[model samples]
Target: MSEFLIYEQQGPVVTLTMNQPEQRNPLTGNTAVAEFLAAIDRIDADNSVRCVILTANGPSFSAGGDLREMKRQSTPAVSEMDIRQEYRRGIQRLPLALFNLEVPVIAAVNGHAIGAGLDLACMCDLRIASDKAKFAESFVKVGIIPGDGGAWLLPRIIGLSRASELAFTGDTIDAQQALAWNLVSRVVPHAELMDAARELAGRITANAAHALRLTKRLIREGMHSRLDTVLELSSVFQAVSHKTPDHMEAVNAFLEKRKPQFGS
Candidate 1:
């Protein structure tokens, strides 16, 4: 039902492929954000989904916002406040929905990820880059800023200094440089990108489903919460995880020296 997303599932892994190859899958000034939020909401509610791979169909992962649309809306009729409100009700929702997603999300960067495009990859829990992938935090080049939370997300992935360099210079970095900066966990052949993503997803989905969600929440909370707060959250999550059917199955499977069959 999504206008721009090609939602496909294989076992416990869901793949959200941005299907705008010609337009480079621009997130804003189009249906991408709405489709993404809807899909993410469904994934959050579906316990069967343990992992998600976010990718695109075209040469560019995403070219960010639509420049022609921006130019059209730059008229005097559209005030500064109007643009601010537009963003608040538009692209800003992407970070919120993606960040709070219950299942782990992996970005399979196939090609160029520019400006907000790069930030979208950062929102994922993990990034697997194609050898031909290129990235740039290039808002400055367009006389704009990263209105999609790149300032926060980029710094957490790479160091503040490195993120600053990218934002300030607005320069593009290839997949190898991204790997060196720890921007992406792995860089594989472009032809093998999806295979690598699936292989990683397989390892993640092999674990107990409920536990994986709980562990991801604990990790996210630990990023911003105090140690004591994280400890409290961990205890609560641990207690809940201990009660899951998957947990019991895992324990029994280990005891019996067999593989676990998780219903969820």
Candidate 2:
């Protein structure tokens, strides 16, 4: 595992914190992508993790690519093919891993999220930003494009019009603006961000775990599939869900007027 990430679990929830505070938690020039992939694989294998909270340990959520690393790679010795291979083997892998994760994920944005950082937040199913948080699709300002799948992720979250504006201008938007643009669901005081995230996770985990996973899958499928395709997938998943112990427990508890005690 990389020193850049801190992975911890509590009951049904897993928290992944980016810990490279002194360097602003950059995604490149480090082992962050590999660690994230490994941590995600571990979480997928663990049956109990129903929810995830993604946040950073310091002021900036992530500085996107490491500028120092970018400068180092800009030398004439680094060919176009080398850079292409670098991305395919590096930060580009994170979008597919995080987005395809089965459990629900919440990003608690504590501060600035720029370029790939903003794209990272978009990878989560939900986002809760601190009142102090700022976001920007800022690759243009750095004289580069978002080579980390920001082009696709940003437009999907905030729509093509808003995404286009941000990409073209590379201007920063604060928490309130982010909420207005639907980039983030809610904005809370910086001090209350983690509390808010935990409370939301609690609400999510109170239901049948199997049902939650099925529901998340349905939502993700709906994002890219046709209505008929999603409905077909939903039917099959629902059938599987109906046979689980937790589903039976949920139904019986409702009829008995008591709380459900679901199994893992």
**Best model per lDDT:** 1
TM-score to native of every candidate shown: 0.98, 0.98
Worst 10 residues of 2 by lDDT: 208-217
Give the alpha-carbon lDDT of every model. 0.93, 0.92
Segments of candidate 2 deviating more than 4 angstroms:
none
Q: Which runs in model 1 stand beyond 4 Å of their true positions? A: none
Where does candidate 1 clash, by residue pair?
Answer: none
Output the worst ten-in-a-row residue range by lDDT, candidate 1.
65-74
Instruction: Give per-residue CA lDDT, model 2, range 1-264, as digits (tens).
Output: 469999999999999999999988899998899999999999888889999999998899987999988997899999989999999999889998887788899999999998889999999999999999999999999999989988988988899999999999999999999999999999999999999999999999898777887888888888889999999998899899888899888899999999999777
| Candidate 2 vs. true structure, TM-score | 0.98
Q: Provide the RMSD of all predictions against the true structure, rounded to 1 decimal.
A: 0.9, 1.0
